[model samples]
Target: MMVDVLYLTAAVCFIFALGGLSRAESAQRGNLCGIFGMAIACVAAYLSVNSADFWFILIAIVMGGGIGVFIARAVSMTALPQMVAGFHSLVGLAAVLISFSACFAPELFRISTPSGIKVLSLLEMGLGSTIGSVTFIGSLIAFLKLQGIYKGHSIPLPLNAFFASSICCLLFYFTVTESEEAFLLLTMISLLFGATLIMPVGGADMPVVVSMLNSYSGWATSGIGFTIGNHLLIITGALVGSSGAILSYIMCRGMNRSLWSVIFAPEQAKANDAVASGGTRAFKSGAPEDAAFILKNANSVIVVPGYGMATSKAQYALKELGDMLKKDGISVKYAIHPVAGRMPGHMNVLLAEADVRYDDVFELEEINRDFSSCDVAYVVGANDVVNPAAKNDPSCSIYGMPILEAEKAKIILFLKRSMGTGYAGIDNELFYASNTMVLLGDAKKTTEDIIKAMRE
Candidate 1:
């Protein structure tokens, strides 16, 4: 009865945690709720286990907890996506390990009958193992791409769909036959399938990939939960799976691409046909003083931040600039693209870290129309999100994707290091817009210079 009550409490906490995460204001509370819930669930699971398993579980907990703490403290915000991928891989691997252990000791797990293994138990084991294997390798590949270990380009494989389907069929057959050799074969093939699935995806779509892998990891965990007959794990896994799926869908819609296009037809969406034409366009350049002068006189300003801001660690400098502009009676607002930076909500996270006011920040849909009435649109290290090509040029890779409408502003000031293309390897036409001027330098240094000029 006590254990059941604890499980129910943990479930409630997990739901609250997810709710809190829906908005930035409640994100911290959501984290706290999740942590407390997990703690309660862990205690309940530990208490339910036999005395013989206690020491092993204790050692595992201490080691895992220590490693988690160290990684959380050491990892920088820029590497958060990679870290998340790595963690998902670990979760998948855990499911695989547990499935194997249960297979070796069916009596201990209560899955074995006097005659043979229960058919339902075998089915659960097979599904859990297959999903876990795929998730483990898929997440590893995602981590490699995010970490720059693997080139973030699609690797074409002939008959990829046929091979994947065949593998699934074989895995199902092996599960029914209860063949140990076939189980090993299924694991290897599933791993290969996972790698192939992610290898074709480009870097620009990594946010969606990360979220999709997270969903896989959750489903894998739920499969293991079924095998172990643990209701808490089931509930937690379902929550994670559903939430991850929703996030992935949201990201896909934000990029104006279907989920199918993101996964299977990524090459079509990311092909760069406009690269040759980009070099012929003319653009105006400006200095820090010019930017400062324009910004000082502006009646309203909208600051757009992207991955470059994160790379340069310039959120604090940006906040300072915004504060300065606000003091001059200029209405200042921040416009955040959903898929900005390397991950979803990446810009918001960085700005929040620098203590930027939440009320001052607005998403693309909210602040997009406001750009036309604004005096200046200040772009910091962002490229694709503010590019007019997304809306105007059908030949462009990012065509039809909704943009921040930075071009609609009376004046556009871009802070960049060079005229390089963005993650999709396509040039931004916004750089050549008649009303736009580029301030070429390090984003942090440039922002600091502008701030200093304002003070002077």
Candidate 2:
């Protein structure tokens, strides 16, 4: 009865934790709830086991807890997505290993005469192990790419007989594999397959990749539940897997991309030229004093942030500029697009770190309705989020993706360092908009200068 109660409480906490994570205001609380719930579940699981090997479990727990704490404290928010992917990969790998252990256990295998139930279990174990192994290696590669440990380059797929031959070989191997050794070999091959798959995708596609891997992790855990006959694990895993798939689909649509394209296309080959469109007309650059002059009298200003802000650690400067504008009685608001930075909620983490007020931040939905009302939109080192191509040009790669219509504002101030394209290798149409004024420099320095100008 106590065990049932403990499990029920764990389930409730997990649900609430996930619910809380849906909003920025409650994210921290959600994280705490998740941690606490996981703790309870772990304790209950260990207690339920009647075995006498408590010392081994204690040591494992202590080591795992120590490592987890170190990682959480050490990793920066910029690399959080990659870290999460790698962590999920580990979970999948663990599930696979556990399932494999159960399948080949000496005592169980010795007693069975290969009944239909045994065959089905073996098949499930093989499938789980293969998929989990692939997810593990794929996520590791993603982590390497995001960390700059690997050269972020695209790998082209063979289009002719080589591709056809490889697929045939993989199919033949899968069809013939019935033994545990063959399953292990297949797992290794799938791992290699996953590594090759994610290597061709650029950093810009990481959010979707992370979500997809999350789903794989969940499914792998579900397979573990099948192997162990654990209902709770199965339910939790299904919940995570389904939700992750939905999130991945949404992210793909948000980027005007297909999951297949992301999985298969060469990153460089799939580049979109956003600034080269017919509507892209570059205006004469304005002097800082002139730019300041125009912004000073603006009735409303919207600030847009991107990955560049995180890379340069410029949120503090941005907030300072916002304060100066607010002092001038200009209504200031921040516009955040979902895929603005390297990861999901990237800009929000940085802004929160800088102690920016939650109320001042507006989501894409809220800010879109107010774009026309905004006198000026100051784009800080963002390229794709403010690009008009996402909405206007069907021929463009990012067509159909939602964007901040900063072009509609009477004045658009873009702060960027160079003509070099963003992660998608696309020039920003927002940079060339008629009302747009480019301030080419380091984001933090330019923002600090603007704040100084405002003060003077």
Candidate 3:
């Protein structure tokens, strides 16, 4: 009765935590709620288990928590996406491990009934193992790609989908037949299928892929939860799965691509084609002094940042410039695209780290229209989000994705490294716009130079 009450309390906390996560103001509270709920759930689970398992569980908890803390403290903001992928892989692996343990010690897991092993328990073990195996391998691939160990291009195998389908069918057949050997075969094949599934995805769509993999991990956890008869795991897994699925759908819609295309279609070739076919177009270049003068005279400015800004660690300098402009009585705001960086809320996280004001930042839908009326649209290390190609070129992979309307601004100032294309590998037509001026250099240094010039 006490364990049941604790579980119910944990569930309530988790529900509130999710609600708190919906807005930035409550995000910290949400995190606290989640942590508290997890603590209670852990205690409940530990108490419910046998004395023989206590020491093992305690050791595992200490090791895992210490490692988690170390990683959380050491990881940089730019590598957060890779870290998230790695963590998802860990969750997958845990599910797989749980399934394996259940298989090896069905008595310990209470899976065997008076009439041999329960069919439902066997089904849960099969599904849990398959999904967990797939998620583990798939998340590893995603981590490698995000970490630059694997090239972000599709590696296609002929009849890959057909082979994956055949594997699934075999796995189902073996599960129904209760063949242990076939179950092992199913696990191996699922791992291969997972690898193949993610190998075809390009880097540009990694955000969606990560979210999809997160959903897979959640479902795998839920399967394991059912196998273990753990209510807390079931509830938490459902929440995570639903949230990840929603995020994936939102990201897919933001890119103006279907979820099917994101998963199956190769995008690297399309991006390369867009770049190759786009002929060189001339554009005006300017120095930091020139940009300073333009910015000083402007009545309003909208700053747009991208993955490059994160890579260059320029958010601090960028915030300084915005603060300077604000002191001069100019209207300054940040225009954040839905898919601006490597992960969801990447730009926001960076800016927040730099102590940028919450009210000054606005999402794509909120600040997109204001760009046209603004005196200057200052782009820092962003390309595709401001690229007119997304709007004008139907053949481009990123076509039909809504942009920041930077081209609509009276004057556009772009701080970039070179004429190099973005992650999408498409030429930015906004660079060639008559009202745009390019400031080529490292984003942090350039912003600092502009600030110095403004003071001079």
Clashes of each: 0, 0, 0
Best model per TM-score: 3
lDDT string, candidate 1, 217-288, tens digits = 989988988887778778888988987898899888878888877778767644573543345667899989
lDDT of 2 at 1: 63
Q: Quick one: ranking by TM-score, best first?
A: 3, 1, 2
Q: Give the range where candidate 1 is weakest over 10 consecutive residues by summed lDDT.
A: 269-278
Q: What is the TM-score (0 to 1) of candidate 1?
A: 0.95
- The candidate scoring highest on lDDT is 3
The segments of candidate 2 whose C-alpha lies over 4 angstroms from its true place after superposition are 1-5, 22-29, 106-117, 152-178, 266-283, 286-290
What is the descending lDDT order? 3, 1, 2
Clashing pairs in 3: none
- Residues 337-454, candidate 3: write the lDDT tens digits: 8888877888999999999999999999999889879999999988888888888888877889988899989999999988878777777878888899999999999999999999
lDDT of 3: 0.86
**Total colliding residue pairs, candidate 3:** 0
lDDT of each: 0.85, 0.75, 0.86
Model 3 off-target regions past 4 Å?
A: 268-279
**How do the predictions measure up, each by TM-score?**
0.95, 0.88, 0.96
